[model samples]
Target: MAFNTCVSVIRSASHKAQMIHNQDVQAVSTDVINADELWSFVKKSKSTVNRKS
Candidate 1:
């Protein structure tokens, strides 16, 4: 009765928390990849400029 209701509520909250955590992890990974790509592009352009000069 009341106990089962409490258990269900707790399970629901836990599931929501897990979902939010997964989303955060995904966002961080995407940011890291973007940063790496930007860094590589900057390096390449710098090298090309140096070669021309």
Candidate 2:
């Protein structure tokens, strides 16, 4: 039960953080983008990601 609670809290925080990040990203225009860094930040290889592909 404790583990599930912790996961829920972390997930909530992650969503909030992602939302803020998305807004920031949209507000700026950059010529160079690093896909690998973004993927690493979101844990692309792990199951925590909503979309694996």
Candidate 3:
């Protein structure tokens, strides 16, 4: 019975860790995409302003 309880606890902890890791991966990907998009917009705007001047 003790062994079974230990196994159950380990499984639960592992599952929680996996979920947290997945969430972190998603957040990082979203941040990277946002940064890339912002950079592109800034570059385009700078070029446009330079042309006008």
Best by TM-score, which number? 2
Clashes of each: 0, 0, 0
What is each predicted model's overall lDDT from 0 to 1? 0.89, 0.85, 0.89
lDDT of 1 by residue, 18-46 (tens): 99999998776343344788899999999
TM-score of each: 0.48, 0.56, 0.50
Poorest 10 consecutive residues by lDDT, candidate 3? 26-35
Candidate 3 lDDT tens digits, 1-53: 69999999999999999999999887763433347888999999999999999
Give the lDDT of residue 5 in candidate 1. 100
Model 3 clash tally?
0
RMSD of each: 15.6, 7.8, 15.4
Residue lDDT tens for model 2, 1-53: 69999999999999999999999988998898779887886685575555645
Rank candidates, TM-score, best first.
2, 3, 1
Question: Cα RMSD (Å) between model 3 and the true structure?
Answer: 15.4
